[model samples]
Target chain A: MRIEEHPILDFKRGREIYFYYNGKKIKAYEGETIAAALYAAGIKTLSKSLRLHRPRGFFCGIGKCSSCLMKVDGIPNVRTCITMVREGMVVEDNDMELPDKEYEGCELRKKAVDVVVVGGGPAGMNAAIEASKYARTLLIDENPRLGGQLIKQTHKFFGSRRQRAGTRGIEIAKELEREVMERGVEVLLNTSVIGYYKRSHHFLAAADKINRIVYEIEAKKIIFATGAQENMLVFEGNDLPGVYGAGGVQTLMNVYGVKPGNVGLIIGAGNVGLILAYQLLQAGVGVACIVEAMPKIGGYFVHAAKIRRCGIPIYTRHSIKRAYGDGKVEGAIIGELDENWNFVEGSEKDIKCDFICLAVGLTPSIRLIAQTGAEISFINEAGGWVALHNEYMETTKEGIYVAGDLANIEEASTAMIEGKIAGLHAAHSIKPIDDFERKIKEYMEELEIFRQGYFGERPKKAKEKILEGYYEKMGERRSS
Target chain B: MKRWEREGVAEIEDIRLPTKEQLQKGVAIIECIQEIPCNPCVDACPFNAISMENINALPIVDFEKCVGCGKCIEVCPGLAIFVVKAKGEKATVMLPYEFIPLPKEGQMVKAINREGKEICEAVVKKVRKGKTPVVTIELPAEYAMEARHIKVKAEE
Candidate 1:
């Protein structure tokens, strides 16, 4: 199921190309990902689950989750969602990794920059753009293209004018990329950061999708806008072949114009879920309904209202029990949850559907930040274990900062603002800018606007506590 | 009210409406209550009537200086502002409308309330397809503030 007509986005009319999946011929566009090609060919079962040998489908199409891992040629564990398709490439489902054998034609190089920003989504881009103004900055992303989620976001954004309110995300992404390039920030696409060396402040990176050449980047300071990965719900047959993350479905449909399925069930009623539901409908997918475990809908009422008025039913206080199908998802079992969250007896009902999208939420990617010896604490209010940082977006460790979903699981707008703040902080620490305090105060105020009112009150207080915790920990270290 | 309750959000119930004297003085009512991160309304007013001190603070309007130009109505992204001019038993309500297949002039359409529920029918009078597109609908005086959205048809 692919979208033929869209109201806002004009999915580029790209030239078609041919690829090989399991040695069989599959046609795809030149710029499409392998997962998108296979999904468009009606191949949902990407690989077998690690345990039970059951089929596993796509989730977190951004390469965060291993559900979309597959063997390309002799390579195992290659993320198919971020891997671009080429002509006649053999794609198979299996385990693969950097081969144990001796290296062949591998290029190893090293370079240094004043600042390096990882994960070129909203955070990284904004970080690079802001920091490059004072220092030489290098921005890197694993995807072949930049703009992480913004590349797939087709809806208009919400924020003040400087935040690009009412502007579609893809357009905003292009604008950011333009500014980043114009500011002379070095950007490397299709490059993944492999590891970080705390002692040397060197980060190992790899590029060139299939056969990557490795390089080392030594940075005076580094910031991570790596973003977050989607969280999956556990249930009977939850690893079915047709299940995908709400963001994963958006990646397939909005980014590649390939709909996840003809009919689908969205499993969360939050902002991502509701937005995906509407985008799914816009992509010509018949959405059955939205299911939320919470007693009330979690997303903005304006967004929920758009779909409700458009005739999509939202079932609250209900959860999925199981997904059943012989080899692929054919339907789902849902039941009402009581006050204690246990399924009520005799409330099970079956919904016929081809796919289920999990929009439960996201868990931040804090591995790199923690590996750098930065202080990290598990804060559920901040969306899981996050690197403890001050209000300047500086982590406990010197010269290391965290921004975007990696620091907190907020969406794009906040990520953009945080990235700017972090980048400014890093740059100022190195080569101080003029009127730095005033500029920083302006940005902090800008950030506060997003973190205010009833919705933002929790994060506002949480941020205060995080800062307080950081100071206390530092105080303990100094006194000892 | 819940966050998504549609009505009662950006609570405009307590906004002070213009009295007959103030109405003759040409005042515009700022019903925005939610401290959302939007200020196009505050910036769009040319009469220096609307001001927001804090970024997240609700905008305040100086009724005496408000010329009722309805510039704020065109620029409000939330679609929360409205301009009311009382007629004998009817009033003209100017609102921001962005949907496609817009109602034609003199077209009788179903008028909806803040909750998006159809309450009555209204006649479309003016459609200003400008930088900030707006449509003026004439309805009963009681629905001056109630009618915020219009349903063109059951299927559109």
Candidate 2:
């Protein structure tokens, strides 16, 4: 089903179109993704698992997860979540059978730039905006449009006045996009950076998936603002078709106007989970309840209160044991957790719902930056393994910087500040700006204000540990 | 533990409620007890009634200077602030509401408390439309402090 009305967001759909799914004709819109159109038409099972043939639906709607990979237009493994639907296009489940077709040669392109920002989220856009002031900057993203995750956020942000605290995330994305365009920052969307080659200089091999072209980019500095991926939870029937990530549900409901399910069960009670619950209610969907393993709610008290006053129950110290259904999620088994983190005996209760959302946490997507020989270490407070970067947001390897979730998992406000710091420092290193030091100090001060709160304690400590490691590695390099 | 910590419902004693004299002249009640990294309410107040030592500190409202303009209600990202005023047997409570099919003027609705329980019937007095609409309701003075939200009855 599709959401017809919402309190906050307005879905401006494109012209209606028709497509084929598994040889059956399905209605779609011109701007709708294949996965979204299919979900809206009550087709949840997109693909099946390789080993056991388990059904899998849309999980991470940002094209990060492989749950929604389907064959489109004779291509074997196209990410349907990011590919827009065309009239009369044929989309089918990936059968792992290769099609016998001649391949066309991809056009090769080569260019050099002063700075290359590798993400289009809040961090990368800000980085490009700041870096382009002093250098020839280029921004790239793997999505069809810019604003990686911000495009789906419908709530206002929390920060100081300078960071646009009262502004909504979608509006902020538009502002950043306008700034990048006005500052003459080159933007390349629908492109994925495949590999990094340490030749005479650093060469980044990128592929334009839409245009069928390859670009060999040589840059003096690279800022990897590559965001993050949602973490999955393990349970019985967890890989079912209706089990979705919290961000994935947001993308479907807010971005594409597709209702995830009639009634949903949310796992984890962090900000993401709590916010998703509220957004679901706004879309006229029923929320069964929110279950958190922790004794207390992990999100803001205001967020909890907002939903609680609306008659939504929050079960603390509870965790989902299993999701059960024939081919999709029909319900879930939840149980209470004891003080020792063990499930209480006989506390299991069945909650009837059509879909389950995982909002457990996120890990930094460091595969691209890690391939560049940047030293990464495991820091529990920073979510998981993260690239070691100094106060300037530069990784151990010179000329390669990491910001946002790639550096650590934090709020978008802090990510933007980190991107600004990285961009300013990278540009100064190339062109020697006069106000570089002053601007860096100002950004660091803003970051300090954000990290001074109770919720910021863990991220503050994690960032300190990362900076300490960065300095130690630098000291060893100097001694050797 | 406080009720807000365990059940997500702020008890009257746990929050900074307005004094009887302050309630006579409509004062803002801030239910935000957590020390989050936010300070929009501080700048949203034109009378400078809301102040915080730092961005992370809890906001303290000066009832003596507050005029109950309801400006902070719209700016607060938490939607935790409310304005309550009592006049003899009746009182008016203003809250930030963001929902479809908003209650019309003079329409009867169910006034809900912090625990999501309907305490009493209330009549909608005024509705100021904006990004987050502010709905003012009139109810018994005794239930003014408890009512934080309103539920419109489904049309037949």
Candidate 3:
């Protein structure tokens, strides 16, 4: 049960209802989605991972990831995190069989457009708005909403007045979306850009839907803002059905209004893991513990303090040994690690938990960009594979541009600025390159301010290194 | 009226006294302990009684022109506040209580201090329980000097 009154934002929870998990009846709420009820009822481990068969629960409750994916009414792979439950809707777990016919690709329209954006997140939204100044832009998103991970963000953002500091991320997303639509940018929801290819001066986007329409956009430039995918960690019995990505848990609790677990254990100390821990408590679920292999917490101290005051312990230098259960996760074995990162003998601790949330890291979804045959590089600072691009986000391929997490994994604020540059450069192609240079300087300064505090060190350094290498590699090509 | 009387603030009832410092600050921090969500006291004051915007925002009391009318005390759902006056080694404390066998006027009772420790004997000057079952107990000068928060003793 949630606290009656909160010191911060007021929680206007909906009327209560009931649902069933594995044939056992459980109480939920009417307005809230299914995942919320399960968390409130102390149930976690919604399903297992596909390859590892690890128990996965809701981490990001925004439906961006498949951590909260479950079989609803005999439909597998349904994002139960965002799916609202109707009365008597049957929900099951521990199932990972693919559908009879897999979706080969999307039904694409062989039509031309001014520009095509591969994402509709913060970066994609800003890119569309900026590009609309010189071209008719098409913004595409995979989810039903445009916010992406912003929907699960209930905490106040830290930025200048222009970025709406002290305002919630979801509110910022709403404002950004409104600004984009007001600029007459065409926004397409529930549209996933499955592939990207460079042709002449434009990039063809193969999108997925009922009818796979391939949009052959005749753009002077294209911005690939496909974003990043969550990284998975492997362990013994990791293939259990009740583990999940950290982002998946956030989606389950905040969006679908369901609890991710009763006694939940989280791996990783990064912002994603810490934020999800707080969200789990807000959903009225007991966080058994937060496990991190690092010697210290990786997220902001304020975030750690928030959970610590609520009695959730942060176990440093600890790693999950294995998740044990039959078909579903019943418990997890956590052990201490030495300085050499080896498991210490006799230091193993057993925690009775149903769900383990993984927030290990993220890998850029650059498959489409790689398919474009653009010069690609493996940059660890970018967190994964990244297309070689100039400061203007223009790749080796003249008209191909990569923005947002596709180019580098950063916060949404930076991604929005990057999107703007990519969108503008893609519109005018040549003239906006100068404009892109000026915007990058301004954003670099703004980003410095965001990185002033102690918590900003690693990410700020990472961003600097990524930019430094990009400019270094470009040499005079960027000037050209 | 004799020692700690203020200039323009009216003491409509001798029980509820307004403090000199409160009069200077132009605000009164009324301590109401009512569990029910009632806002009559907020409405009863003519000079913007209290802000009732959220039904949850704590009430703000303006003391600049309160006049110590005691109308808010009469209307408060939870009889919590007591107008206090402290001066010259003495003080006046007004309290709200509902109990049978009310203390008689000028009767002496054990003066339990703020820490719930008995300090000295206190003389009750006035006791009023209207037909509404609401009672106001006025304690002596010394009781006001020490008492800030209060709870009544159960009669044996």
State in Å the error of residue A4, model 1.
2.1
Backbone collision count in every prediction? Answer: 3, 0, 54
Which 10 successive residues of model 2 chain A have the least lDDT summed? A95-104
Ranking by lDDT: 2, 1, 3
lDDT of 1 by residue, B1-156 (tens): 444442223334556677765664345666665555656666678988888886567788787778777887765644556777775678777876655556788988888765557878899998887534678888887877677677786243
Model 3 docking category:
incorrect
Which pairs clash in the backbone of model 1? A76-A96, A77-A96, A301-B4
Better of 1 and 3 by TM-score: 1
Please give, for residues A1-480, the per-residue lDDT of candidate 2 as tens digits. 888888788889999999999999999988889999999899999998899888889899888888888888888878899889999999988977774431357789998999999999999999999999999999999888888799888877777787887677888889999999999999998899989877766779998877888999999999999999999998899998889999999999999999999899999888899889989988989999999988888989998998898888899999999999999999999999998988899999999999999999998898899899999999989989999988889889988999998899999999999999999999998888987767888999999999999999999999999988888888853321
Which digits, one per residue and each the tens of the lDDT, describe model 1 over residues A1-480?
666766555678467888777779998888889898898888888988676778888888999888888888667788899998888788987864565432367787777898999988899999999999999999988898889899888766666777887566888899999999899998888888878885566464545444556767889899988899889899887788888888988888989999887899999888899888878876768898888998887776556755664457788889999999988888999999999999999998899999999999888898777778888888878888888888888888888989988887876888998999999989998887887899889899888877875567767766877777788887753320
The residue-by-residue lDDT of candidate 2 on B16-127, one tens digit each, is 8768898899989999999988888899899999999998899999998998889888878888899999979999999998787788999999999987789999999999
Query: How much DockQ does model 2 earn?
Result: 0.75
Off by over 4 Å in 3: A1-110, A208-215, A430-440, A451-475, B1-156
Tell me which of candidates 2 and 3 scores higher on DockQ: 2
Q: Residue A167 CA error for candidate 1 (Å)?
A: 2.4
TM-score of each: 0.84, 0.97, 0.65
lDDT of 3 at B154: 30
